[model samples]
Target: MAQKNIVVIGAGFAGVYATKKLARKLKHNNDVTITLIDKHSYFTYMTELHEIAANRVAEDAIQYDLHRLFGRRKNVNLVTDTVTTIDRDQHLVKTKHGAYPYDYVILGIGSEPNDFGTPGVKEHGFTLGSWESAIQLKQHITDVVRRGAVEHDPKKRQALLSIVVVGSGFTGTETIGELRDWRDQLAKENKLDPEEIKFSLMEMAPTIMNMLDRSDAAKAEKYMQKRGIAVMKNTGVVGVHEDHVDLKDGSTFPTATLIWTAGVKASDQAAQFGLTQGRGGRIAVNAQMQSQDDDQIYVVGDVSYFAGNSDRGEPQIVQGAEASAQTALSNIIKQINGQAADVAYKASYSGFMVSLGSRYGVANLMGIFHLSGFFAMLMKHLVNMLYFVQIFSGYYLFQYVMHEFFRTQNDRNLMRGHLSRQGNVLWAVPSRIFLGAMWLVDCAYKVSGKESWFVDKLRLPFSWLQPAATSGASAAGADTTSAATGAAASGAADTATTAAKSVFSLSYQYGKDPMMVFDQMPHWMYSITKVLIPNQQVAFFMQKSMTIIEILIGLALVAGLFTWVSGGVSVMFTLIFCLSGMFYWVNIWMIPMAIAVMNGSGRAFGLDKWVVPYLQKVFGKWWYGQPQSLYGQDTVK
Candidate 1:
């Protein structure tokens, strides 16, 4: 039998996951082949584009490899090429690379930024639609500042630093938040005054974050203003010139950078393929994830017009992309198995997580309750990490962890091609060598059972206690000549060894205190750690441990750095993090770190499994910093 070829287009979140699920579902059948076509081999996370554009993160900070998502699926083949035309009549698709003849076609090709026909918008404005666009925006923003710093005229300098972001949707609002952060960092880095930088977010609608609830929208607007962004409601760009944006109200603002994220329209490719388009030129697909007019065709993600509501009762959102993909994969499996392909997909907004720069944001899970402040920020980061784990199979997450821990500022952006500056390649070679060394060390620590090499090489005093104690015991043994002294020595040795073993064991022991073990602790207590300790006792323990650890680590890393020069730089870098930020000084940062370590790496699919060996190799030698690259170095700094 000729094999059934399932061709999927686009490599966005929907297209990437759709191919994976379909391949898995049809893997048992030898008569099925799953081929995914994308313009790029890797999946670029559209959500984190703002972070890249603002320079808080590298371009690859949010990207995941599609091949990693496929795992060991022999049936899945990834082809990187631009699709020029799709001929449904002949069951064929022509791409710049080659032509694909498919038994079934799934068009998950995502949308492009909507210019809304504003003058000079296409030529002047930067759109955060793809990884490339985001990178370009970041570079352009940096160039603007670099040029402006040398300019003598104050107004011209301000104009050069001025950035106008159109639209107030998730992308628009988030981009503004990042822009504020990047601007702040740039101001500080370049010694330019904050007043010289202008970040304006203009929306035609009555409020920003329009998709969010009214209260959330209000909170977001307030938060944005507090972060130095001017949120203009019921205002929009009527025209965009090379150096300025004319507002709808006829007010004009001088600016060098204009970002058009006002709206999104379906890809012309989708319309050319003849899929029924909705209001935004989005392809309309049936409940089964297949095109309404053709079962062999599937359309998922942002391009798909799924039935849903956004305050007003209307169909929108790409959340249905995942739902549609699942259904399409299920249908494809059933079709290959000679069974009924009738799985219906019902789209529902499960949750919404948004990152508002480094500090604050809003979320309404299932549009039921609103979350903001630290909780929302945590949720947003988790959402990003989860997506990383999902698509890249945690490779980039591990890369993130390694970079966070060991890589220097110069080293962080070395492999990131999108973050290149017009500098000599000389700095990059050493950076690559350093990363390569870290990776090799990580691999060795994994392959070999050398879990403590990092600690040993770094010679952390906490770890050195073992050798110090052994030396003390040896000294005591040498002096013990009497029977009574020998007996006392033996007893002390046994007690000390038992205590050390208990403290060294990373796994939580179930035996606990005999008193608690005898209590036959309630089943709920196992899930809830708080119940195990009374609130008062919890407070007491935290108060005591918090100060002691903070002081000791602070003094040792900070004060001790002034004494020693070998690990001084790394220690100072780590210590500066502690004293520099008020957030780090608070309980918020430590509490989460403690909880994550205790919970054992998000239960499953975390990079912990990969990080364990990597950390073991560099454990003592270098501090394992947070898993984000270079503390937003690519942006302004």
Candidate 2:
């Protein structure tokens, strides 16, 4: 059988999920191959772009590596290129790099900001359509604020500090909330008055968050107003200039930054495909998400116009995108197997969730449950985690949680400006190497002997003590015989053998018996350890295994690999020793030192400082928690 090549374009929510579904279904089939193409090598979590722009989260937090996403799938091929056009006659998708021939093509190219022919808007305003754009917006805001902080002229400073956000939909509202919080932080850090900053959200509609319930929308608006953000209703931006924004109502706002989140239309690539364009310049599709002109071509995501149980059209939300993608992939697979395209696209609206900032949110679940404040914020995180787990790995979920919930303002401040210039490596390098060497020496000594110290102690109480004693006795007997000829030499030998025997006997009594150590422990700890390991044989095996593990940990620490992991293990070991009645004065100091090492002491001079960022770039942002230096530089703030 000839192999069927299925091409999926874009790596957004729709493209990603569709490729995953297709890969899973065709994993065992040798007759089918899936190819995924996207302009960027990484997939951006579009929903979280606002957080990036607000500086609430790191830019890397919203990206998932395309290579890693398809790394394990043998039948999936990933192409990082922009699609320029589609050749329907030859069944080929032409990209900037090359053309991919396909038996079927799934277009999930997503959407672009709609400037709506507003004069100077596209040239002067920024939109949150892509990751790069969000980053640009963030950097521009930072630059503006910094300039404002040092400006001597009040008018110029006000203009630099003022920010106008056009449109009060989900993106606009969320961006304003985050921007306001960020502005306050920036002002405090720069020793400027917070009152100097001006933030506004302008919408042409009667209410903000139009997709949200009326009560929820009102609550959101009130929350924004309470936080000192100007909420303008029925206000539309007619044009934007380099230093100010012009509203449709003949009002002008002097601002250096104008953010356009007014609306989104189908990506220009949709029209380039020569497909039947429908409302909003999206590709027209049937109930199954197949193009009206060709059954072999399917469209999904924001670029696909599908009217499912709605007169207007399906909402261009992540949930709808996923559902449409699923339906489209199902139909494509069915057609590949010479079966009918029976599955129809269904629209599902779980609810709308909007994060006001790190501390606040408003959400309506299933149109029945209303949530706000901290609980709503928690729910928002949960929803993000769910989607992350579905589309990416648990690493991304962990990163999201840490960035959203645990990372402090101080930590985020480290990520600002040039990260490559921060952190002192002088002490970190030597300290890590020295600590690792100590562990390695300890491990080597324990494993070098025919029977390790632990094993010797374990066998001492059983049968090895008698053999040791006999050996000592034989040496003493030899010493006695030699005494007949050379009394001085014989006496010295006898004393040495006697000392050795005594030392062995002491070790046998104390070392072999962990119970003796347990007796010295506090009653509370003693009872816990006793209950934990009631079996003597099991305890012996555990001791041996721990020794081997220590050896591995030592090697890793010495190599400067997984520095934090090794340090954490060292802490665990120290704690275990302390609880087992081995609490020496040195052990107490080791605990704190281990903690220091775990907190990125390796980054100062060790391999981790350099390797971590590289790994994060190649594998995505889920490598570890916030580093001491975010982009290889110290905290600028």
RMSD values, in order shown: 15.1, 12.0
What residue runs in model 1 are displaced by over 4 Å at the alpha carbon? Answer: 307-318, 388-392, 400-637
Say what the RMSD of model 2 is: 12.0
After TM-score superposition, what is the CA distance of residue 390 in candidate 2 from its true location, in Å?
1.7
The alpha-carbon lDDT assigned to residue 418 of candidate 1 equals: 32
Task: Report how far residue 152 has shifted in candidate 1, in Å.
Answer: 2.5
Scored by CA lDDT, what does every candidate get?
0.62, 0.76
When summed lDDT is taken over every stretch of 10 residues in candidate 2, the lowest stretch is 626-635
TM-score of candidate 1 relative to the true fold: 0.65
> Over the stretch 417-520, how does candidate 2's per-residue lDDT look in tens digits?
22222344456656677778878887776775766746735521211223344332222222123435584564467556545543322123543321222213
- Which lDDT value does model 1 have at 515? 15
- For model 1, give the 10-residue run with minimal summed lDDT: 513-522
> What shift in Å separates residue 162 of candidate 1 from its native position after superposition?
1.4
